[model samples]
Target: MEIQLVGITVLWLFLYGYLIVASVDFGAGFFAYYGKITKQDHIINKLISRYLSPVWEVTNVFFVFFFVGIVGFFPDTAYYFGTALLVPGSISLVLLAIRGSFYAFNNYGAKDNNIYMFLYGATGLLIPASLSTALTISEGGFIEKRGDKLVFLAKELFTNPYSWSVVILAIVSVLFISASFLTYYADRAEDQKALELLRGFALFWSLPTILASFLVFVTLRQHNFIHFENIIVRYWWMFVLSLFCFIIASFLIWMRRNYGTAFIFVLFQFFFAFFGYGASHLPYLLYPYVTIYSGYTNETMGIALVIAFILGLLLLIPSIILLMRLFLFDADYVKGKK
Candidate 1:
């Protein structure tokens, strides 16, 4: 009900947007390359390329909005997370640059460069792995404030079990989310070959996604008991629903029916879990460092930001849907009739 809560909820929605869109973009790159190596490129690469061509340019818009909004709405995050995120943030940026170069090179320069494809595929996984550090660091053990300086324990982060677990989850979740959506997208395209291939990918990653989730929860109990307790007591229902959605999604995918419906369930699966984790971690943007109450901007600025982001969301969601209608889901375009 408070401005801070509302602000974060909106930001969380943006981040969720980034998660789904970018996962599809990222996993498409990996699948694109995987299809190549597996000698199945002729089967699904066109489908992947079609999905990426229009959507890739906009995938990061959600992320850019979230990054700016977090700092705008919670200025304290800048000081607390800035230094702590330096290396991981830089790694992600570099990976992003490499991934972007693939777009340019594949489009104009070298359409079939193996080196470029490798970078494209590698960054697909690497970016998410590096970015997941923010969530891991957020569980609140890797940063220290001493005297007048804020220190980031890079070694501690690398060595942390929960950190690795979260990274693993991010990679598998990216693949899972991407494959699920792409399966449906392939089905929409009526490319039975691609649909079967992507459906198999979706099913393969399903169990690993759930397992990685449990590993994070188990590791959370030891890594940050307070947040873990919050998860158990306050937000367990969200996770339960997440699991249920996963079950429905997996069953449908396995049954090879209603691909679109299955992917929607996959989205809900993560929506419940993601927001639930976020809701339980409420108040604190970074444990022991920044709370939404303590970190929020002043009321006037906060209201301005909230409205701006809401408008941005309103614009973004419709733009994507319209894009789908115009290009992605167009009867001609999707089926290669055009």
Candidate 2:
């Protein structure tokens, strides 16, 4: 009925598209590793690397562009939207970059070069540091109100809670980076002893990242952290559900022999995350900052959503068909493997 409502609906539908693509791709990757598919079958690796991986990567790029375009259209809303997206988007980007770098290193035999290894390790650390800094600034801890203007003083910025969050994030980031390096070195050595050590490091260090993310969400909710009351009301339940799903999925992943089971669990995790995010931020393109009613008010936008929803179903139906074909007819690829 209104422009803001229509815009919010379209944005959320786009996000659903993104979640579908991302979950499938991420599930495929997890199965590839869990099933040791790469070692057993080149076809499986090729399917993942050539098809699924690119799909996720392209989708991620589109996600970035989609938000960037929205912000461009509504400059006044950019700060709030950017603040909300900074932490999660940056985490995904950095993790994907590290994974991509690892793929390149393996493909090109950069493992033998100590300089290359050093650079890779340094890049990994830098990703987290840069993200932490961005998240801190985006959280608005340094801004001082001076009658319709926000000013940042260096001294205030340094002493803010955002700064402290950055420090904590940085510490966790280093742990993760170190874990990655350890795993890389272990792989290069091909020594069972080294691999075991690295695996332990990875498992231990990974927990902190998860914990930190949970803490952030918890604090956000406790403080009524973000703007927009409706988002807080609807999505708070979803976040709670997501935390439960994460714990359950992590346990299932540890115990399950069938990699497909673990893959499914991971998809559920993503689905929960998507639902929480979308539901919480509904009726507003950007929470705490911009609302749908304020941005645009055209019936055309509503019609567009109806049309897009139909198109989404069309696309989704075909994907289900293809997935069924793979599940039933392509048994050779997954059977006894998971």
Clashing residue pairs in candidate 2, if any?
3-296, 3-297, 4-292
Model 1 scores worst on lDDT over the 10 consecutive residues at 107-116
Instruction: Report RMSD for candidate 2.
Output: 8.5
What TM-score goes with each of the models?
A: 0.99, 0.53
Per-residue lDDT of candidate 2, residues 7-91 (tens digit): 4555555555554454344434443342242243232333333334224335454355346435544455565544444554577
Best TM-score among the predictions, by candidate number: 1
State model 2's lDDT: 0.47
Residues 1-338, model 1: lDDT tens digits: 88899999999999999999999999999999999999999999999888888888898999999999999999999998998999999989999998998888987897878788888989999999999999998889899999999999989999999999999999999999999999999999989999999999999999999999999999999999999999999899999999999999999999999999999999999999999999999878999889999988999999999999999999999999999999999999998877
TM-score of 2: 0.53
Candidate 2 weakest lDDT stretch, 10 residues: 34-43
- Candidate 1 residue spans exceeding 4 A from truth: none
Tell me how far the alpha carbon of residue 71 in candidate 1 is from the true structure, in angstroms, after superposition. Answer: 0.3
